[model samples]
Target: MSSTLLAPVLEREEYIEQAYFFRTLAERLREGVPAQMALLQIRDELLTTTRLPWAVEFLATELKHSGQLGSGMKRLIHYFTPFQAFVMTKAEEEGVRFSLDHALKVLEGEARYRSENPTPAGLFVYEFEVLARCQLGYQNGLDCMEQDSFFDEDWRQFIETVRRSMSEVEFADLIYLYSEQYIQDQQRAGREGPFPRPLFGLKEGRIAKASHGRDPLYLFAALQRQLGYPEVPRLRLPTEQRGVLQMLEHKVRELELRLRLLEGEVRGQVEVIQALGKPETAESSLEWLKRLDNEE
Candidate 1:
C-alpha cells in the first residue's frame, strides 16, 4: 500500500477549499460546462492562499493533455488522498455506470465533512456507506479506506479485518463486537479472556447491537441519527431512470417551443423557414431549449 494514507497533512482551509472545488466542479458539469473550462473557472474562485487553486490548475492541464482528471489526481499524491484517486479512477473506468460528476459530489461531501473535524469512526462509517450505497467494490474500497491517514493503526487493522471477513460477517455484528458495550457485556457475563481494544464507543455498540441481523444500511442510519455522523450523499439516478427523465424533459421543451411558434405565427411575426433557420441557441424562445431532436 502507498504511504500516502499515513495522516492528513493538509490544513483545515485546504479541506474547505477542496470541498468548494469539488462542489463547483460537479455543479458546472451538471450545467453542461466542459470539464477543463469548469476547472479553469473554478480555479480563479478558490482562496489564493490555499493550495487547491494550484491543484485545480494542474488538474485542468492534465485534463487538457490526457483527457482525464483522475490521472492528474493520482499523480498529486501529496495533495489528494489515495481514496480520492481510487474513486476518480473508478468513476472514469469504461463500462461503469458511475459518472465523474457523481464521483465529484462524493468527494465534495467527504471534504466538507473533513473540514468539520471528523472523528475516525464517523469518517469510517461515512466512507463505508459511500462505497456500499454507490456499489463501488467493497474489497478495493475498504482497502483504500484502511490507508486513510485519518485512521489510526487500530482503525486500519479493523478495516483490514472487515475487508477480509465482510463476506462471512454481518457488518453490524462486527461493529458490536469491537465496541466498548461488547466488552462491558462480556465482563458482566463472567467471561474474562483477552478482549480486542474497543475502536467504537458505547453509543456505536448499542446502535450496532440493535441493528444486528438487519440491513447494514439500517446500522449506518442508526449511527447517523444518534451520533451526528456525516450523511453519505445518495447515488445518482440509475441509467434507465435518467433516460426516462431526459425524454420527458425533451418532450416538455418541444411542446413549449411549438406553443411559442404558434403564438408567433398567430401574431404574423414568425415564419417556419425563419424559425428553422435560426440556431438552437438563438436569442428567441428557442434559446432556453436545446434542439430537442439533437442526439446526445
Candidate 2:
C-alpha cells in the first residue's frame, strides 16, 4: 500500500488505543466510580503509553476517514499538522490548557456521533477519532464545550454564556427536541400546581388557547417574539439560535454606533451652517446649495 494510504491506518491504530482508554474510564464512571479515580487511570495510561505526538497523529488519520472533520476540523489540523501529514502540519506555537472534564466532554461528543449514526466494525474507530480530538484540544487548553470556530476565544465564551442564559422555554424546547414525553410531563405538572415560571409561559391557559392548533414552528416563533428575541427563520435549528443572537447583538451595537457617529457629523455640519448665517429659508437654502453644487 502507498505510504499515503498506510499513514492513515497507522494513525488509526494509535486512536484505537486511546479510545479504549477513554471507554474504560467512561464505563467506570457509569458504574459510580469516582471521577478522580477514573481520571487517574486515564492519566496513568497516558504516562505509560507511547508519546502523545504519536497518539495525535493516529486521531488525525481516523478523523479523515470518519468525515466528522469539517471546516472547523481542517482549521484545527492546519494549526497542528506536520510535513508529509495527509492534513496540514504546522508547529504548535501557542499552548492550550484544558481540564480532564473538558477532554471527557470532547470525547463524549465524538462518541455520540457514532451512536447517532452507527456502522459495523467502525464503532471503535469512531470513538478513537473523537478521543484523539479531545486529547488535542486538551493539550491546547482549548474549551471543548464550544463548537469549533475561527474566533476561538470569543466564540467559546459566547457559546457558554448563551447556554447559561437560555430561558426556561428555550431549555424546554431543547429538551422537547431531544425528549418529548419528559417535556410533556413537565408542562402538565406546571399547569396543575406551583405553576413554575416557564420561559415561554405556554402553561398559561390563555396563551395555550391562543396557540392551540399551531405548529411547533409557529409556537416557537410566537414565544421568541414574546420573549423579545429577533424573528428567527422557521427552519433554523434550535442550537443555532445562540450564535444567531450573538451575531445580531454585534450587528445592533455596530449600527447604533454608526447612527451616533452620523448624528454627530450632521450636528457639526448644522453648527457650521448656523454660524455662517441664518438661512433666508431652510428650503431655499437647501435648494441654493444644491444649485451651487450642480453649477460646480
Candidate 3:
C-alpha cells in the first residue's frame, strides 16, 4: 500500500499502546499469570492515562472488525512492529499463524481474487486483509526483539513486575512512549489521516429537514445507532436542514404551476366545443345557405 494510506493506520498512538499492552499481557499469560488480572491491569492503565481511553476506542473498533475480541487481540499482537513482536509468547505466535492461514484460505477462495472460480465471498476479504497487515507488523516486532533488548529489561518480565514495581506516573510515561512510537510507526507507514477533517458525523451543517423530517438531534441519534458518539461533548444542530425544507417547498410549487397550466388548456378546448354547438344568427344562416347553393 502507498505510504499515504498506511500513515493513518499506523499514526494512531492507541495502536502502538495496544501493541505494547498486548505484548505484555501475552507474555504474562504465557508465563502463567491469570488472564483476568492481566486484562484488569490493562483496563486500569488505560483509565489512568489521559489519551488511552480515546485510543482504546479506536483499538476496540479494529478488534471488532477483525472478528470479535479474541481474534482481534491475536491479530493485533501479531501485527506489531519488529521490536513489538518479541513480547509475544509461542502460543500467541501460533494463534496469529492460524488466523493468518485461515485468512489466506478465505482470500484464495474469494471470487474477486480467484481467476477460474467465482463465489459470493462477501466482504470478509477486507477483514482478512486488515488482519494480515496486523500480523505482518507483529512479525516485524518479533524480528526486532530477537536482535537486541529494545528496553532495559526483558519486556515479558517487566510486565510481570509492572504492578509491584512501577508507579502510576512511571507507567503512564512508558505507555505514552509506546503509544507515540506506535503512532509514529503508523505515520511512517503512511496510515494516518489527512488530518484536520472534522470527526465523522460532526460536520457544521444542520440536519436537513428533508431527511425524513428528522431534526439535528434526531439525526444525530440515528447516527449514534450506527456509530456510537465520540468521547467529545455533544454537537449542536446546524441551519442546513432549513435549506433542505425550502428546496422541497420550491419543488411542490413547480408541480402546482404545471397542474394549473394543464387545467387551462382543457378549459379552452371545452369553450371552443361549446361555441361550435351554438345556433347561427340570421346573417350567418343566410351566408351558410348561399355557400351551399354555390357549391351545388
Better of 1 and 2 by lDDT: 1
**lDDT on C-alpha atoms for all candidate structures:** 0.83, 0.37, 0.35
| Candidate 3 clash figure, as a count | 25
> What local lDDT does model 2 show for residue 83?
14
Off by over 4 Å in 1: 1-7, 236-296
Please write out the lDDT profile of model 1 over residues 145-198, one tens digit for every residue. 876777888888899999888889999999999999999999999999699999
Candidate 2 residue lDDT tens string, 1-296: 01111111123334444445555654676567765455455555563444433444444454456532222233333322211121111112125343333343444433333334333212322222332332332212222323222223433343344345443334224323223333456567774434322222223223334554444445444543554322211122235557678678766655654464465456665444334443354334445444433533
lDDT of 3 by residue, 59-164 (tens): 4565455523334323343233222222222224554543322322222222122222211111111222222334434233323333322222343333333334
How much is 50 displaced in model 3, in angstroms? 4.6
Model 1 whole-model lDDT (C-alpha atoms)? 0.83
Model 1 worst lDDT run, 10 consecutive residues: 287-296
Q: Over all chains combined, what TM-score does candidate 2 have?
A: 0.21
Task: Score every model by TM-score.
Answer: 0.79, 0.21, 0.21
